[model samples]
Target: MNERLLPVLDLVSSRTADSAWLTFTARLDTAHRADLRTARRLLAEFGAPTTNPHEGHDMPGMVTDEELAALRSASGAAFQRRASQHVRAHLEQAIRIGSAEQRAGVHPATTALATKVVRTGSAELTRLDRLDRTTAVNRDW
Candidate 1:
């Protein structure tokens, strides 16, 4: 593959492989996001809890009596407001880590794409990180 193709393939292939490795990572990620949404909805339905327990398959575990009390404290039409605040905070942390990684030499910044000078046909490459040892074939190619 050419220069442009290599990085694109590398990124896509990693995601594809990772997606398969963790079968439910993508699904769980989606559902985790949905938990925050459900949290809001549950806030509205807050009764004495003698009515509906509000349990679900993908919820963020059992809410303590204290937590229910906290959510109850917020007056007004505030539905699922806690979920929104928590989700935003979590996403902000992920974004900050991503930004730092981008600033570091990890990514091929700008597609200005300086040659990384990867040496081919090395026995060392064959013995490297991946236990699958695609590197042996890498040297062959």
Candidate 2:
């Protein structure tokens, strides 16, 4: 999931006209990168298999290749709108997954990371909602 988010973050940062959205994307990028590092460290510490289970699966909140292609062709506000929508979906799905981990995960470190994921993702969702509201109001005026 973090791997998938990196390109979208770069795309949105490059094409978005909204400063707030750009900043949000940057924050997501940083958090996701940290999540990846934590995941790697945990895997090594516990000697768990490092294979990606979701590599080919259609996971929720994962943007499709076609969607990414379209995003690459978009510009300005269009890019921002689509990017925001995709990012919201991604965050929501991540939070759901994290919440599940928190409930059923056996490992202390893993569950702790899940808690952080839920907390951070929820905050990002709130920020995304505010940006949407502001964008809608600006469009109306």
TM per candidate: 0.25, 0.93
Best by lDDT: 2
Off by over 4 Å in 1: 1-28, 31-79, 105-141
Q: What is the per-residue lDDT of model 2 for residues 1-94, given as tens digits with 9 covering 90 to 100? A: 8877788888975686678877888888999999999998999999988998788666779888888889999987778788888899899999
The prediction achieving the highest TM-score against the true structure is: 2
Ten contiguous residues with the weakest lDDT in model 2: 132-141
In candidate 1 the C-alpha lDDT for residue 24 amounts to 26
Worst 10-residue lDDT window for candidate 1 reads 112-121
lDDT, candidates in the order shown: 0.31, 0.87
- Residue pairs with colliding backbones in model 2 are none
